[model samples]
Target: MPGPDYCDVDVLRRIRRRSLAALRADVEPVPPEVFAGFLPGWHEVGRLRGVDGVAAAVETLAGTPVAASALESLVLPARVVDYRPEYLDELTTSGEVVWIGAGASATGLEGWVALVPADAVADLAPDRRVEITELSQPARWILEIFAARPAGVGRFARELAPEVAARAGATAPPLPPPTPAEFAEAIWELAWAGFLSNDSLAPLRARLGGSAHPATLAAPATRATRATRAPRARSGLRSMRARRRIDAPSTTAPHLSGRWSLVPGAGEATARILGRSLALVDRDGVVLRGSVPEGLPGGFGSVYRVLARAEESGQVRRGYFVEGLGAAQFALPEAVERLRAAAAPAPGPPSGLVLAATDPAQAYGAALAWPEACGPGGHRPGRKIGACVALVAGRLVFYLERGGRSLLTFTTEPGVLAIAADALAEAIRAGRLGRITLTTIDGAAALTGAAATAALRGAGFVPHPRGLRLRGAMSRPESVSPAAETTAASGPGAGSGPGSGLESAGGCVDA
Candidate 1:
């Protein structure tokens, strides 16, 4: 682990893996005994009191509010999604609240979202719809415009074309004028691409030729609209739109909404994009080009230079941290600090950590390579949202693919697989993943394999005709499975608890 200010990327990698798993660890913090006894009677019961409350308990939910997914509050942090699931459900699709566009694949604004107050819309509303990214061509062409100027969103591009042409030294005509239909189509592309947007879904509703919201759509086909890729160039605008359904919110909604402005910073557009790139690299702690969206105007070279300058300024550091990520890696100095001090194999048995395969913690396919698949010719598991991964001591142990039908075991070790299986059962019992009905493991029928059966039964899975079924936390009994029943018969310290069955393979942490 000796590596200087930063741990050797090997050690750092292990630390980061565990950190990602713990980023959303399911735990409730409790005060120490000293404070608890010192402040006796501090516990207060009331109707959602503020932090100013005399007791320790405060700012808790006394009731429900609208959310897109019912599990949002129970399982995730606030504002994790731009707006909660279906947050815009009740609002008029064409009124003050609006839907903007999404970034072209991986720009800086992928997960980040913007919101504005109701009255702010009067000043922020687009008079002519913003369409700067495309018209500007190479962003540097009109550096002087975006440099230190918050170009009004409502301003017309036609009005600014002359300055752009003169600045870029272009001898050609100012710009071509498009037919009405062509103009409308171009605007839509920019809107969805997130260069410009408005509060009203009216335009988008018109385009989808039906309900503005995907949830309201009659067909499930459009559910994957965002999966469609729009080309990176302006020339493809017309064909791209005509080629697909272009469902407003489906493809990209719940983006920069309510109120927003273009040209966010007080510097050249390229510089702003570069700075945003640095900010992203800085925020992510450790980042390589693939993880950051700093490749548009100047590509990775620009980002590299900015990071290099930051390195010189002592604002950041550079290294060939992780192998295969190239030498241009940059990380916050504190990240190195954490990398040095953070990880150690815990004293007891390694607990399994279960998170969505796509969760930042499941770095297997991205930061690191996935272990060779156990089954011959078995397709590598995809790191998708619906799929889940189980980890022990920063190493991947299992992958439960979408729909919980296939389980991909990363390890053949009986001990780790048993712990992972018990972790899955704990996840189901906690209602974290709801009921899990897995049909297969390692490409074999779920129940046919001796290893799979022992693991599942140890974790509480019961038989289903198609495969094996485990009830969700809400529907299940106090005990988990036949194995738990046997353990319970042995008395306390055996298997009375939610995750107690893992004792057969050492032990397990409640994932």
Candidate 2:
């Protein structure tokens, strides 16, 4: 069989669909061997040291020249992934030492006093496949970048490719097998790191090595950032925007190791795990008057300090950054999906349907309004009159007939107002109906009264004043007294009375 087709949109759509179906694939970094030749001054790890050595290596690796064998010492076991930092103060102010390792487990720190659970470095690995026989500061920086933003790794990798390629000179390797999973992992990391924008070099898809394109990178990152930030941002920005948007914050929007958003306007600001709060900075670089609350997992408490300084100067960026954290640390794809959906764009009204009537139908003639995404078999409830109290698909609709002649249908929800306005104007142009007069009624059941009027207008029923007078005279044929007429009106089966003509459709009777 041939290999998978390449395209950014296709990759994004496929991942989105697969993720929705619970069949998501994992992104793994390319092997070190594939790109070994490209990385100059690379070193290999020798033997595995215990947890203490690994921690020491982490503390000093940034400043010291790394040997090849140091990578082995940094490898994380799987067990450490289970421990999460609960109290913010313990890890930062307490001077408590946290273990950062290649394996997933925190066992190396067991029985060691002052030892606290730490984020696994392996959790930050990018999803792409590349060979590396040696190590360098840049590689370490790349690892840290992944740790901070697991979602953006793929895009970031593409960004770093030119730099890395430039550094490689004649030693640059061929394009490695950078699969979709790796691209996704890269994206996750980038998102975590506050690189919220997509920098996909489109029309140059072949350069990214995998089948992914640049456009695919745009929405997920934007959606993830919006979903993650909306709750906090909505309240802060409400006073600025002209229109007020209804915000639905995440309740089950996963709170993986990274901060997840909560519902908007629920009395929560940018929540910080530490006691300190983050100041809100708008897109225009203006900081809100009040300080915004910002939260961080225990290991990243130091980041808040940096952010606070930035906030004071009104230059603070509003996003989270985990220094050197990897993608696997808090793999909550489910939470990510929830946030994405919550932040997904709301669809516009369906095209081509006009609103003919609304509740309080008596006051207004046939007014047109925009039709909602409702009706029979339109996945909307309250399509029938008196269906339910709750507004489903905006409002209730009822079919009507005046004098037993079918008339136009109407929507009761106020969303139909704009629709009605536009549609009625069109009808007047087409000469379908006369001047449209819209009305409002208190309830869906009340619209039954206006049905007759709307039916007359729709069917162009010509009223005969003389004919009505004759019927009235017939009712009082022998000079019947008003008291007798009242008695005759009250005595009824299903004819011109409360329960009349509705027995086939669950008629009501007043005992």
The lDDT values for all models are 0.43, 0.24
What TM-score quantifies how close candidate 2 is to the native fold? Answer: 0.17
Count of clashes, each model: 3, 78
CA RMSD, predictions in order: 16.9, 31.7
Per-residue lDDT of model 1, residues 1-511, tens digit only: 8876856888876775565335313222212211111111111211122222211110111111111111121112211222222333223232334333433212211111122222232322222223454443433333444444555444233333334334333335433333323334444445544455444433333343211011122111222224545535545433333223222333233221233224222245555555555644543455566554323457667777777777656677676544455656776766545443324234788666565554333456544557766765334676443456776656677777655555777667888778888877876666555555555667666666576567777787875544566766566353446764443334222322333212221101111
Alpha carbon lDDT at 17, candidate 2: 56
> Candidate 2's residue-wise lDDT over 249-290, tens digit each?
211112111221110111222232221222112110111111
Off by over 4 Å in 1: 1-268, 293-299, 323-325, 474-511
TM-score of each: 0.48, 0.17
Cα displacement (angstroms), candidate 1, residue 368, comes to 2.4
**Consecutive 10-residue window with the lowest summed lDDT within model 2:** 465-474
Best by TM-score: 1
- The CA root-mean-square deviation of candidate 1, after full C-alpha superposition on the true structure, stands at 16.9
